[model samples]
Target: MDSNWGSSSNLDSEWEEHRRQMMEEDEEDDARMRTNTQLTATAATLWTQEQIQQEGPWGGSVVGRSNKRRGRALGHQKLMMDYFVPNPIYTLENFRRRYRMRRHVFLHLVNDIPNVNPYFRQTTDATGNLGFSPHQKLTSALRMLAYASLADQINESMRMSESTSIENLGEFVVQLFTRTRMSTFDNQHMRT
Candidate 1:
Protein backbone atom coordinates (compact mmCIF):
# COMPACT_ATOMS: atom_id res chain seq x y z
CA MET A 1 0.00 0.00 0.00
CA ASP A 2 2.82 2.38 0.93
CA SER A 3 4.71 1.64 -2.31
CA ASN A 4 1.62 2.26 -4.45
CA TRP A 5 1.01 5.64 -2.72
CA GLY A 6 4.62 6.68 -3.21
CA SER A 7 4.48 5.82 -6.94
CA SER A 8 1.21 7.74 -7.40
CA SER A 9 2.63 10.85 -5.69
CA ASN A 10 5.78 10.59 -7.87
CA LEU A 11 3.61 10.37 -11.00
CA ASP A 12 1.57 13.41 -9.94
CA SER A 13 4.72 15.50 -9.30
CA GLU A 14 6.19 14.43 -12.68
CA TRP A 15 2.96 15.35 -14.46
CA GLU A 16 2.87 18.74 -12.69
CA GLU A 17 6.48 19.43 -13.69
CA HIS A 18 5.72 18.55 -17.33
CA ARG A 19 2.70 20.85 -17.35
CA ARG A 20 4.74 23.70 -15.83
CA GLN A 21 7.44 23.31 -18.52
CA MET A 22 4.78 23.34 -21.26
CA MET A 23 3.22 26.52 -19.82
CA GLU A 24 6.64 28.17 -19.69
CA GLU A 25 7.29 27.26 -23.34
CA ASP A 26 3.89 28.61 -24.35
CA GLU A 27 4.58 31.88 -22.50
CA GLU A 28 7.97 32.22 -24.27
CA ASP A 29 6.30 31.61 -27.65
CA ASP A 30 3.67 34.25 -26.87
CA ALA A 31 6.38 36.73 -25.90
CA ARG A 32 8.22 36.07 -29.17
CA MET A 33 5.01 36.62 -31.16
CA ARG A 34 4.31 39.89 -29.33
CA THR A 35 7.86 41.10 -30.02
CA ASN A 36 7.56 40.18 -33.70
CA THR A 37 4.25 42.03 -33.97
CA GLN A 38 5.76 45.12 -32.34
CA LEU A 39 8.74 45.02 -34.70
CA THR A 40 6.42 44.75 -37.72
CA ALA A 41 4.33 47.68 -36.48
CA THR A 42 7.46 49.75 -35.94
CA ALA A 43 8.71 48.98 -39.45
CA ALA A 44 5.36 49.89 -40.96
CA THR A 45 5.30 53.17 -39.05
CA LEU A 46 8.82 54.05 -40.26
CA TRP A 47 7.85 53.27 -43.86
CA THR A 48 4.74 55.44 -43.60
CA GLN A 49 6.73 58.29 -42.12
CA GLU A 50 9.32 58.06 -44.90
CA GLN A 51 6.62 58.07 -47.56
CA ILE A 52 4.88 61.05 -45.98
CA GLN A 53 8.19 62.92 -45.86
CA GLN A 54 9.03 62.13 -49.48
CA GLU A 55 5.59 62.93 -50.84
CA GLY A 56 4.80 66.58 -50.15
CA PRO A 57 1.32 68.04 -49.63
CA TRP A 58 0.53 68.42 -53.35
CA GLY A 59 2.15 64.99 -54.13
CA GLY A 60 2.37 65.50 -57.90
CA SER A 61 6.17 65.58 -58.08
CA VAL A 62 6.71 62.38 -56.15
CA VAL A 63 3.82 60.69 -57.97
CA GLY A 64 5.23 61.60 -61.38
CA ARG A 65 8.84 60.93 -60.37
CA SER A 66 8.81 57.22 -61.22
CA ASN A 67 6.81 57.49 -64.45
CA LYS A 68 9.20 57.21 -67.43
CA ARG A 69 7.57 58.33 -70.68
CA ARG A 70 9.05 55.93 -73.27
CA GLY A 71 8.76 58.16 -76.38
CA ARG A 72 5.55 56.51 -77.56
CA ALA A 73 5.16 59.10 -80.34
CA LEU A 74 8.40 57.97 -81.96
CA GLY A 75 7.34 54.36 -81.58
CA HIS A 76 4.01 55.14 -83.23
CA GLN A 77 5.76 56.86 -86.14
CA LYS A 78 8.12 53.93 -86.62
CA LEU A 79 5.19 51.50 -86.55
CA MET A 80 3.31 53.55 -89.14
CA MET A 81 6.32 53.73 -91.44
CA ASP A 82 6.96 50.04 -91.02
CA TYR A 83 3.43 48.77 -91.71
CA PHE A 84 0.50 51.23 -91.83
CA VAL A 85 1.70 53.71 -94.49
CA PRO A 86 0.70 53.56 -98.17
CA ASN A 87 4.26 52.65 -99.10
CA PRO A 88 5.26 50.82 -95.96
CA ILE A 89 8.68 49.34 -95.33
CA TYR A 90 7.24 45.86 -94.89
CA THR A 91 5.24 44.36 -97.77
CA LEU A 92 1.70 42.99 -97.65
CA GLU A 93 3.05 39.46 -97.46
CA ASN A 94 5.33 40.48 -94.57
CA PHE A 95 2.42 42.13 -92.77
CA ARG A 96 0.24 39.05 -93.29
CA ARG A 97 3.03 36.76 -92.14
CA ARG A 98 3.78 38.81 -89.03
CA TYR A 99 0.20 39.69 -88.06
CA ARG A 100 -1.36 36.34 -89.04
CA MET A 101 -4.17 38.27 -90.72
CA ARG A 102 -4.85 40.39 -93.80
CA ARG A 103 -3.84 44.05 -93.63
CA HIS A 104 -7.39 45.15 -94.39
CA VAL A 105 -8.78 43.00 -91.60
CA PHE A 106 -6.21 44.42 -89.17
CA LEU A 107 -7.08 47.96 -90.22
CA HIS A 108 -10.82 47.27 -89.94
CA LEU A 109 -10.35 46.04 -86.41
CA VAL A 110 -8.26 49.09 -85.51
CA ASN A 111 -10.91 51.38 -86.97
CA ASP A 112 -13.85 49.65 -85.31
CA ILE A 113 -12.38 48.84 -81.88
CA PRO A 114 -12.17 52.45 -80.74
CA ASN A 115 -15.90 52.83 -81.39
CA VAL A 116 -16.69 49.78 -79.29
CA ASN A 117 -14.25 50.61 -76.47
CA PRO A 118 -12.91 54.06 -75.70
CA TYR A 119 -9.75 52.66 -74.14
CA PHE A 120 -8.29 52.36 -77.63
CA ARG A 121 -8.76 56.08 -78.27
CA GLN A 122 -5.69 58.24 -77.89
CA THR A 123 -5.83 61.12 -75.41
CA THR A 124 -3.46 63.70 -74.00
CA ASP A 125 -2.25 63.63 -70.44
CA ALA A 126 -2.60 66.56 -68.01
CA THR A 127 0.88 67.68 -69.12
CA GLY A 128 -0.31 67.70 -72.79
CA ASN A 129 1.76 64.58 -73.60
CA LEU A 130 -0.05 62.36 -76.08
CA GLY A 131 -0.97 58.92 -74.87
CA PHE A 132 -0.49 55.76 -76.97
CA SER A 133 -2.53 55.70 -80.13
CA PRO A 134 -5.07 53.00 -80.98
CA HIS A 135 -2.61 51.66 -83.54
CA GLN A 136 0.09 51.19 -80.93
CA LYS A 137 -2.21 49.45 -78.43
CA LEU A 138 -3.71 47.13 -81.05
CA THR A 139 -0.32 46.35 -82.56
CA SER A 140 1.07 45.46 -79.14
CA ALA A 141 -1.95 43.29 -78.39
CA LEU A 142 -1.84 41.59 -81.81
CA ARG A 143 1.90 40.92 -81.57
CA MET A 144 1.43 39.31 -78.17
CA LEU A 145 -1.41 37.14 -79.55
CA ALA A 146 0.32 36.18 -82.81
CA TYR A 147 3.72 35.38 -81.33
CA ALA A 148 2.59 34.07 -77.92
CA SER A 149 5.21 36.53 -76.64
CA LEU A 150 5.60 37.87 -73.13
CA ALA A 151 4.32 41.40 -72.37
CA ASP A 152 7.86 42.63 -71.68
CA GLN A 153 8.90 41.59 -75.22
CA ILE A 154 6.71 44.37 -76.67
CA ASN A 155 8.09 47.07 -74.32
CA GLU A 156 11.08 48.27 -76.40
CA SER A 157 9.35 48.20 -79.81
CA MET A 158 5.92 49.37 -78.63
CA ARG A 159 7.21 51.91 -76.08
CA MET A 160 4.81 50.56 -73.42
CA SER A 161 5.37 48.88 -70.10
CA GLU A 162 4.83 45.16 -69.57
CA SER A 163 1.83 45.93 -67.34
CA THR A 164 0.37 48.25 -69.99
CA SER A 165 0.90 45.61 -72.66
CA ILE A 166 -0.90 43.02 -70.55
CA GLU A 167 -3.70 45.47 -69.83
CA ASN A 168 -4.08 46.26 -73.52
CA LEU A 169 -4.19 42.57 -74.37
CA GLY A 170 -6.91 41.91 -71.83
CA GLU A 171 -8.96 44.92 -72.90
CA PHE A 172 -8.51 44.06 -76.58
CA VAL A 173 -9.75 40.53 -76.07
CA VAL A 174 -12.79 41.62 -74.08
CA GLN A 175 -13.73 44.36 -76.54
CA LEU A 176 -13.22 42.13 -79.58
CA PHE A 177 -15.38 39.40 -78.11
CA THR A 178 -18.06 41.92 -77.27
CA ARG A 179 -18.06 43.32 -80.78
CA THR A 180 -18.16 39.87 -82.34
CA ARG A 181 -21.01 38.75 -80.14
CA MET A 182 -23.06 41.86 -80.87
CA SER A 183 -22.49 41.48 -84.61
CA THR A 184 -23.39 37.82 -84.51
CA PHE A 185 -26.57 38.61 -82.56
CA ASP A 186 -27.52 41.30 -85.07
CA ASN A 187 -26.98 38.93 -87.99
CA GLN A 188 -29.04 36.21 -86.36
CA HIS A 189 -31.83 38.66 -85.56
CA MET A 190 -31.83 39.96 -89.12
CA ARG A 191 -32.08 36.45 -90.51
CA THR A 192 -34.90 35.61 -88.12
Candidate 2:
Protein backbone atom coordinates (compact mmCIF):
# COMPACT_ATOMS: atom_id res chain seq x y z
CA MET A 1 0.00 0.00 0.00
CA ASP A 2 2.87 2.39 0.71
CA SER A 3 4.51 1.63 -2.69
CA ASN A 4 1.16 2.10 -4.46
CA TRP A 5 0.65 5.42 -2.71
CA GLY A 6 4.16 6.60 -3.74
CA SER A 7 3.51 5.60 -7.40
CA SER A 8 0.22 7.51 -7.44
CA SER A 9 1.95 10.69 -6.19
CA ASN A 10 4.70 10.30 -8.82
CA LEU A 11 2.12 9.95 -11.60
CA ASP A 12 0.35 13.08 -10.38
CA SER A 13 3.64 15.03 -10.40
CA GLU A 14 4.45 13.78 -13.93
CA TRP A 15 1.07 14.83 -15.21
CA GLU A 16 1.43 18.30 -13.62
CA GLU A 17 4.90 18.72 -15.17
CA HIS A 18 3.57 17.71 -18.58
CA ARG A 19 0.69 20.19 -18.27
CA ARG A 20 3.11 22.98 -17.22
CA GLN A 21 5.41 22.26 -20.21
CA MET A 22 2.47 22.36 -22.59
CA MET A 23 1.29 25.68 -21.15
CA GLU A 24 4.78 27.16 -21.52
CA GLU A 25 4.95 25.98 -25.17
CA ASP A 26 1.55 27.49 -25.84
CA GLU A 27 2.70 30.84 -24.36
CA GLU A 28 5.85 30.77 -26.50
CA ASP A 29 3.78 30.14 -29.63
CA ASP A 30 1.48 33.01 -28.77
CA ALA A 31 4.44 35.35 -28.26
CA ARG A 32 5.94 34.31 -31.61
CA MET A 33 2.65 34.95 -33.37
CA ARG A 34 2.40 38.40 -31.81
CA THR A 35 5.93 39.26 -32.95
CA ASN A 36 5.21 38.06 -36.49
CA THR A 37 2.02 40.09 -36.64
CA GLN A 38 3.83 43.21 -35.46
CA LEU A 39 6.60 42.70 -38.02
CA THR A 40 4.08 42.26 -40.83
CA ALA A 41 2.24 45.41 -39.80
CA THR A 42 5.46 47.43 -39.74
CA ALA A 43 6.47 46.15 -43.17
CA ALA A 44 3.09 47.05 -44.63
CA THR A 45 3.23 50.57 -43.21
CA LEU A 46 6.72 51.13 -44.62
CA TRP A 47 5.64 49.88 -48.04
CA THR A 48 2.63 52.22 -48.04
CA GLN A 49 4.78 55.18 -47.11
CA GLU A 50 7.27 54.39 -49.88
CA GLN A 51 4.45 54.10 -52.38
CA ILE A 52 2.99 57.41 -51.29
CA GLN A 53 6.34 59.16 -51.69
CA GLN A 54 6.81 57.69 -55.16
CA GLU A 55 3.26 58.45 -56.34
CA GLY A 56 3.07 62.02 -54.95
CA PRO A 57 -0.34 63.61 -54.42
CA TRP A 58 -1.93 62.66 -57.76
CA GLY A 59 -1.51 58.88 -57.49
CA GLY A 60 1.11 59.10 -60.26
CA SER A 61 4.84 59.62 -60.65
CA VAL A 62 6.08 62.74 -58.91
CA VAL A 63 8.40 63.84 -61.72
CA GLY A 64 5.60 65.16 -63.94
CA ARG A 65 2.87 65.89 -61.35
CA SER A 66 0.52 63.92 -63.58
CA ASN A 67 -1.90 61.14 -62.84
CA LYS A 68 -1.29 57.75 -64.42
CA ARG A 69 -1.52 58.52 -68.12
CA ARG A 70 -4.25 56.47 -69.77
CA GLY A 71 -3.43 57.47 -73.35
CA ARG A 72 -6.24 60.01 -73.50
CA ALA A 73 -4.99 61.35 -76.84
CA LEU A 74 -5.18 57.89 -78.38
CA GLY A 75 -8.62 57.38 -76.86
CA HIS A 76 -9.82 60.70 -78.32
CA GLN A 77 -8.38 59.86 -81.71
CA LYS A 78 -10.15 56.52 -81.71
CA LEU A 79 -13.43 58.12 -80.65
CA MET A 80 -13.25 60.70 -83.44
CA MET A 81 -12.30 58.12 -86.02
CA ASP A 82 -15.04 55.80 -84.90
CA TYR A 83 -17.95 58.22 -84.97
CA PHE A 84 -17.21 61.94 -85.33
CA VAL A 85 -14.75 62.43 -88.16
CA PRO A 86 -15.72 62.84 -91.79
CA ASN A 87 -16.33 59.40 -93.30
CA PRO A 88 -16.14 57.79 -89.87
CA ILE A 89 -15.73 54.05 -89.42
CA TYR A 90 -19.33 53.74 -88.23
CA THR A 91 -22.17 54.99 -90.40
CA LEU A 92 -24.78 57.53 -89.27
CA GLU A 93 -27.24 54.69 -88.69
CA ASN A 94 -24.67 52.95 -86.51
CA PHE A 95 -24.04 56.15 -84.61
CA ARG A 96 -27.76 56.63 -84.05
CA ARG A 97 -28.16 53.05 -82.96
CA ARG A 98 -25.33 53.29 -80.45
CA TYR A 99 -25.93 56.84 -79.21
CA ARG A 100 -29.71 56.77 -79.40
CA MET A 101 -29.54 60.11 -81.10
CA ARG A 102 -28.51 61.67 -84.41
CA ARG A 103 -24.95 62.90 -84.89
CA HIS A 104 -26.14 66.51 -85.20
CA VAL A 105 -27.97 66.37 -81.86
CA PHE A 106 -25.00 64.81 -80.14
CA LEU A 107 -22.75 67.46 -81.56
CA HIS A 108 -25.15 70.18 -80.44
CA LEU A 109 -25.16 68.81 -76.91
CA VAL A 110 -21.37 68.54 -76.95
CA ASN A 111 -21.10 72.13 -78.12
CA ASP A 112 -23.77 73.54 -75.83
CA ILE A 113 -23.13 71.67 -72.57
CA PRO A 114 -19.73 73.24 -72.09
CA ASN A 115 -21.26 76.71 -72.24
CA VAL A 116 -23.64 75.90 -69.40
CA ASN A 117 -21.25 73.80 -67.27
CA PRO A 118 -17.54 74.40 -67.36
CA TYR A 119 -16.92 70.81 -66.29
CA PHE A 120 -17.83 69.71 -69.80
CA ARG A 121 -15.16 71.94 -71.30
CA GLN A 122 -11.75 70.48 -71.97
CA THR A 123 -8.94 72.03 -69.96
CA THR A 124 -5.23 71.53 -69.56
CA ASP A 125 -4.07 69.58 -66.55
CA ALA A 126 -1.29 70.65 -64.17
CA THR A 127 1.16 68.89 -66.50
CA GLY A 128 -0.06 70.84 -69.56
CA ASN A 129 -1.93 67.77 -70.84
CA LEU A 130 -5.30 68.52 -72.36
CA GLY A 131 -8.17 66.95 -70.48
CA PHE A 132 -11.02 64.96 -72.02
CA SER A 133 -13.17 66.70 -74.59
CA PRO A 134 -16.82 67.57 -74.02
CA HIS A 135 -17.85 64.90 -76.49
CA GLN A 136 -16.15 62.20 -74.45
CA LYS A 137 -17.76 63.31 -71.18
CA LEU A 138 -21.20 63.65 -72.77
CA THR A 139 -20.87 60.30 -74.47
CA SER A 140 -19.91 58.66 -71.20
CA ALA A 141 -22.91 60.18 -69.47
CA LEU A 142 -25.28 59.27 -72.29
CA ARG A 143 -23.97 55.73 -72.52
CA MET A 144 -24.63 55.16 -68.81
CA LEU A 145 -28.16 56.54 -69.12
CA ALA A 146 -28.94 54.67 -72.34
CA TYR A 147 -27.50 51.31 -71.40
CA ALA A 148 -28.00 51.53 -67.63
CA SER A 149 -24.37 50.46 -67.45
CA LEU A 150 -21.86 50.93 -64.68
CA ALA A 151 -19.28 53.71 -64.96
CA ASP A 152 -16.30 51.38 -65.15
CA GLN A 153 -17.87 49.64 -68.13
CA ILE A 154 -17.01 52.70 -70.25
CA ASN A 155 -13.43 53.07 -68.99
CA GLU A 156 -11.92 50.86 -71.71
CA SER A 157 -13.62 52.81 -74.50
CA MET A 158 -14.25 56.22 -72.93
CA ARG A 159 -10.88 56.44 -71.14
CA MET A 160 -12.51 57.90 -68.03
CA SER A 161 -12.84 56.67 -64.48
CA GLU A 162 -16.02 55.45 -62.84
CA SER A 163 -16.24 58.61 -60.70
CA THR A 164 -15.75 60.78 -63.78
CA SER A 165 -18.52 58.92 -65.58
CA ILE A 166 -20.90 59.38 -62.66
CA GLU A 167 -20.00 63.08 -62.37
CA ASN A 168 -20.62 63.59 -66.08
CA LEU A 169 -24.02 61.92 -65.81
CA GLY A 170 -25.05 64.09 -62.87
CA GLU A 171 -23.91 67.30 -64.54
CA PHE A 172 -25.56 66.40 -67.84
CA VAL A 173 -28.90 65.60 -66.19
CA VAL A 174 -28.87 68.78 -64.10
CA GLN A 175 -27.99 71.04 -67.05
CA LEU A 176 -30.50 69.43 -69.39
CA PHE A 177 -33.26 69.63 -66.82
CA THR A 178 -32.40 73.25 -65.99
CA ARG A 179 -32.46 74.25 -69.64
CA THR A 180 -35.76 72.52 -70.27
CA ARG A 181 -37.32 74.02 -67.15
CA MET A 182 -36.14 77.51 -68.00
CA SER A 183 -37.42 77.21 -71.54
CA THR A 184 -40.83 76.05 -70.38
CA PHE A 185 -41.02 78.80 -67.76
CA ASP A 186 -40.05 81.45 -70.29
CA ASN A 187 -42.73 80.26 -72.75
CA GLN A 188 -45.36 80.22 -70.03
CA HIS A 189 -44.43 83.74 -68.93
CA MET A 190 -44.59 85.01 -72.50
CA ARG A 191 -48.03 83.50 -72.97
CA THR A 192 -49.26 85.09 -69.74
**Tens digits of per-residue lDDT for model 1, 90-137:** 999999999999999999988988887899999997899898999999
Q: What are the per-residue Cα lDDT tens digits for candidate 2 across 1-192?
A: 999999999999999999999999998997797566556445434544454455354433467454556777888889999999888999999999999999999998888878879999999977899988888898887887678777789888988866566667766766655665577579779999
TM-score of 2: 0.64
| lDDT against the true structure, each candidate | 0.80, 0.78
Candidate 2 residue spans exceeding 4 A from truth: 1-67
For model 1, state the Cα shift of residue 124 in Å: 0.6
Q: What is the C-alpha RMSD of each candidate to the true structure, in Å?
A: 20.6, 23.0
- Structural similarity to truth (TM-score) of each candidate: 0.62, 0.64
> What lDDT does model 1 reach?
0.80
